[model samples]
Target: MANFTLKVTRLGFSLLQSVSPRIAGKAAFRLFCMTPSSAPKGEKAKVAHAAGIAKLAGAERFTLALQGGGKAYAYRLNGGAIGRRARYLVTHGWGSSSVYMADIIETLAATGAEVIAVDFPGHGGAKGRALHMGMAVKAIAAAERRFGAFDAAIGHSFGGAALMVAAAGMLPSVPVVLPEKLVLIGSPSEMHWLFKDFGKMIGLRRAAQQALEKEVHRITGRRLEEFDASAAAGVIKRPVMIVHAEDDKEVSADHARRYAAAGESVQLHWANGFGHRRIVAAPPVLETITEFLTGDDSVREAEIVPLFDLPARRMSL
Candidate 1:
């Protein structure tokens, strides 16, 4: 039944392309931002994981009211009133919640630094039915306002792009504090490519693509070309680590390479077989991210660990 519904929807959009490309483009934009999957199963497991991490890290969970409307769900681990080492902000990708990033949050918390993870608007417990890159940036800015400045930030997929956009000062009216270090996992380098891909998927033609881009520009006041993460990387002074799996299956590994090529400070880490979502929970990948964030040289000095040699675990994404 689900497959049938999906087919009908796809067919309808395809037909719309022939009749009105402009309308098709608008529909494509809506579909692009919509979360296709239902809420993840294993509700008890997700709760258990969150509870265990909170206990281990001495974390607190709460909600913060968004500026315009709605609310964002967030968790803070370690560093209470007394404060701690460094502070790190973490965010998840589209259609994902902060619970999926529990492993990363737990690991960061273990370092004695305050770690914050948030479910962007429309995902997790946050309010709203639709979300865009701009809103994600705004959510991050709100998190920062409540939690204070961050020494480093780690973002996965769309969340990663928001971090780059924030660092580039592209988010309107939102005050942003650029983190000293950044980690982008399986993130796209160019927003235009994403829009174009969506156009192709929905059978939209050149005119339709232009219409979609213009719609986005209406909201963001920036053209598709202006949303490039590579450009952001060039202007931002912080060191960036771009991690992508060789077989991402979603965003191409070429995006990571493009980011690495953007500047001397950008570093690329290649993982094999981790794919898109699994890369975030891979043990070695986690270790590398932790080491990079904490500035630990021991992990690298010990040996070059082969990816996928470690056991894979189920994550919330």
Candidate 2:
């Protein structure tokens, strides 16, 4: 069934690419940015896992309406400690809701720090079927407004890219207070790579791919090169921990290397066999993330091991 869906999607893209570059670009934009109305595979198990975490952590649900339109859903877990610990903000990847990040949120809250997990526009119970990086930045800003400043942030995949965009001050309308510590998991460092990959998958020519990038620049006011997360990591002056699975078929491990290479404060942890989605729920990865968020500056540097050096392990998302 999944293979059939993939073949159909590829065929549709190939047909669009054969049209004009502009047509292909428009279609790609919609397909990449919009969330489908139907739930993804394993959605039920994901939802159940998240619900269990929320219940265990005593999380409170809330909603924030954006200025332009659309609503963002969030779950807040208050700290149990006597005095306030640092506040942490967590967000899931594209096509996923905050529920998928419940385990991480619950763990952070267990450490006596208040935590908030947000579902971007068009995700979870949020209003809209389309979501862009701009909308995601605005949603994060809205969460901050509702629940004070966050000292640390943890993001997976596209959500991590959104954090970099927010920190770069690209979303001018929605001012963001960049968190002191950041953890990016299975994130793509360069936006152009994603565009190119999509183009190749859709059988688009180089010209058509360029057209798609141009469309992205027209909408976001930033070129594909300008939106690179590695560049953002270089200038952000904050401690960063990049966690990438060597087996992550979605985003390459080179992204982690790029971010870590950008600055001395950036640390890269090479994980094995977690693939893309499963990495988020891995216990060891979770432990490392929590320690980095609470630990001292020493945690900012680590050795990067090759994918072959790590042992293989099977885990479900």
Candidate 3:
């Protein structure tokens, strides 16, 4: 039934494209920005459990008022160390919340760097049904204003792209201070690829595709191709660590290569076995990231570590 509904909807959109590409494009854009609702009982229980654990661990919770009349919920886990603290921020990908990044956040915090994890709009406790790259940038800006500058930031998938776009100063309206270092995992390298992929999935005509591109520019103040993470990496002169799995089925490992090719400051690490999502929680990956964020500059340029040689542990996911 769901597949049939989707097919019928696509056919209707195709027919609408024949009649008016502008209208079809507008509708397609809305659908594209719609955030998935992952509020099943098990998912809710998991989020609740994580929230409970966070509170038990003495994590500080706060909210930031967005510029566009919405709220962003964030978690601040104080570093375990007693002296000066390094500030770190973590953002999750599409359809995921800060809760999903709990492992990474906890690992960074354990390294004695104060970690802040944000739940993007329409995910976690944030309110809204629609989200886009521009909105994600604004959320990051809001977090920065609430909690000064970050020494480093780690983002996975969509969140990684948002961090690059914001740090690169691609969105003029929302200026952001680039983090001293960045860690991107399984993230898309270009925004236009997403648009083209979506177009192909929905069978959008060229006219509708063009119209959708115009709508993106009108809202984000940049063309779809302009939100390129590889280009953004060039603009950001800071160190970047890209960790990707060769077996990642969602985002190609080629995206990681593009980031490394952007500049000398970017390092690429290819982990075996772990796919798109599990890579975030893998123990070896965590160890490497912790070292990169807290270790010396020399560690930033180290070659990829062979995952099979490392001791395997059960994943939390």
Candidate 1 clashing pairs, residues 3+ apart or interchain: none
Q: Candidate 1 lDDT, tens digit per residue, 93-175?
A: 87777777778888888888889998887877677777887777778888888988989999998889889998888866667
TM-scores vs. true structure, each candidate: 0.85, 0.85, 0.89
Query: Which residue ranges in model 3 land beyond 4 Å of their true spot?
Result: 40-57, 79-83, 299-317
What lDDT score goes with residue 258 in model 3? 92
lDDT on C-alpha atoms for all candidate structures: 0.76, 0.77, 0.81
Each prediction's RMSD over C-alphas, in Å, is 4.0, 3.9, 4.0
Per-residue error (Å), model 1, residue 15: 5.2
Q: Native-vs-model 2 lDDT?
A: 0.77
Question: lDDT tens digits, residues 39-72, model 3?
Answer: 6248755765466457426777788887766778
Per-residue lDDT of candidate 2, residues 262-309 (tens digit): 988788887677778867777778888988988754855553333344
The TM-score between candidate 2 and the true structure equals 0.85
Which residue pairs of candidate 2 clash? none
RMSD of 2: 3.9
The full ranking of all candidates by TM-score, starting with the best, is 3, 1, 2
Candidate 1: stretches off by over 4 Å: 1-3, 14-21, 41-58, 296-304, 307-317
Q: State the weakest 10-residue window (summed lDDT) of model 2.
A: 308-317
